[model samples]
Target: MQLFYQNLLPEINYLDQDESKHCIKVLRKQQGDELDIIDGKGTFYKAKITDASAKKCRFEIISTTQERKVAFHRHLAIAPTKNMDKMEWLVEKATEMGIDEISFFQSFHSERKVIKIERLEKKAISAMKQSLKAKKPLLNEIIPYKQFLKETDVSNKLIAYVDFKNKIHMKNELSHQQDTLVLIGPEGDFTPEEVSLAIENRYKKVSLGNSRLRTETAALAAVHLMNLAME
Candidate 1:
């Protein structure tokens, strides 16, 4: 089933401009037509369109229900790549693969320090609808690497780095049905000092694979492995 996103849902009673345009102009949806909507809060609704205008289309809710969250929450925090397109692609694929949350961090060797997460959020929303998922992954604003490391709280914390001595893989490290947070660094990779600090602060120093990966690749690998652990 095709799904649309309008988080406020029956309370707001309408799709925002972008969603309205797609529903009215692009998809040619009309008044009295039924559509599925997700609030990104795990609630899904069946609604009948009240007005199919090219902008600010309105809908009335027929039903609403919440989906069960995944057995485990997979949160990935990564340093943004210099080319923002790669980051965008990562968000799209991660959403399709079902991540619970994503974050950006500005590390010492980060090639890109800032990301326009609004665009990334849109990509995520589109992916969620395309995947027909009822839950939306949380997109976080970019924060200082050190600050993010300090403030993050989760059941499990791991840093996927280029460490040969620390040879444990992510799939082996992740526990079943537990909230897990994994950190992936930039292209130049996380500094040795930062790795030391993360290890000190209870972040496991783990490795993704034998071959090295790009920033986005490593992040996605971590997400994939964590999801695999529960299977």
Candidate 2:
């Protein structure tokens, strides 16, 4: 089924400019054509086009369906890489894999201190629509590493970093049916003191695998592990 997104539902019955153009001009959808619409809030709508205007394609909802709530939440917190393209790739893939939330933090070794959250949000929305998911993952603003750990209040908190002595794999450490939050460090990795601070805050240190991975790769790996554990 072809899915379109319109965050404001019931209250609003028109697709925005971008979506309108895509539906009318690109897809050649005309009045009276049927379309599937989602509000990115776990709600789906069966709509019929009323006006095929490329700027403000209007539709009337024929039916509404609410999706079931997920059993657990998968929140992936990481230090974004200097190259935003990599971070965008991670966000897109993670959204397709059913991530519930993504948080960005700046660590002592963080290369990219600044981030464009608006751009990432667009990427996430496109991915959600492409993957045919009705719900969109929460994209959080970048905050200091310490602030993130202190503010985050999830039950299963984990930190993935390079530590030979800490041999526990994230997959094995995951608690089934519980909300989880995993931390992935920057390319330079987190400092020992930072790790200690996380531990002090009750975050368990875990490993993704034996092979060392880049910042984005490590973050995606943690996301994948969390998805698997939930399954």
Candidate 3:
């Protein structure tokens, strides 16, 4: 079943303009038609259209369901790519693979130090609905790499770096069913000094594989490893 995403639902019995357009004009949903909507906070809702104008389709909530959280939660913190399309693709695929949180960091060698958080969020929402996932991953605004490492804390902390010195594979380092945070660096990869700082800040150095991957590819690999460990 196709699902619609709206952060807040049926508060005043309406969908926002974008969703309304899709429901009315695009899908041709009309009054008394039923559809599923997700609030992106773990709830799936059943609603029936009350008014089906192309600009403001209104609905009445018939029922609500709280989706169960997975035993494992995956949080990925990576440097944003210089190309927005790559980053957007990463967000889409990672969400479909079942990630819980995403953060963008600007590393010392980061080619791109900024990102459009709103645009990233929109893609994530679309992915969540397309994947039929009730829980939405939390996407953080871009922040400095060191700052993010210093501030964030979780049970398991890992950094994917290709210095070839650490030799610890991310797949080997992962502990099943636990909250894991993996950091994927920028295009040129994290500087030796930055990697050292991450180690100093309690992040265990790990590697994805011997085959060198792109920024987005490495991030998606880490995310996949995270999900695979749980399975």
- Name the candidate that leads on TM-score: 2
Top-lDDT candidate index: 2
Model 2 lDDT, residue 21, Cα:
95
**Candidate 3 lDDT, 43-161, residue by residue in tens:** 89999999998887888999998887788778999988899999999999999998999999888888888899888888999999999988889999999987898799988899988
**What are the per-residue Cα lDDT tens digits for candidate 2 across 1-231?**
679999999799999999999999899999999999999888989999999999999999999898777788889998999999999999999998889999999999999988999999998999988988889999999999989988998898999976788788998887668999999988888899999999999989998888878888888889888888866
RMSD of each: 1.3, 1.1, 1.4
What's the lDDT for residue 224 in model 2? 86
Per model, state how many residue pairs clash: 0, 0, 0
TM-score against native, each model: 0.95, 0.96, 0.95
Better of 1 and 3 by TM-score: 1
24-46: candidate 1 lDDT, tens digit per residue: 99999999999899998788999
Give, for candidate 2, the lowest lDDT window spanning 10 residues: 161-170
Q: Is candidate 2 or candidate 3 better by lDDT?
A: 2
Q: Which regions of candidate 2 deviate over 4 angstroms?
A: none
Candidate 1, after superposition: displacement of residue 120 in Å?
Answer: 0.6
CA displacement after TM-score superposition, residue 82 of candidate 3 (Å): 1.2
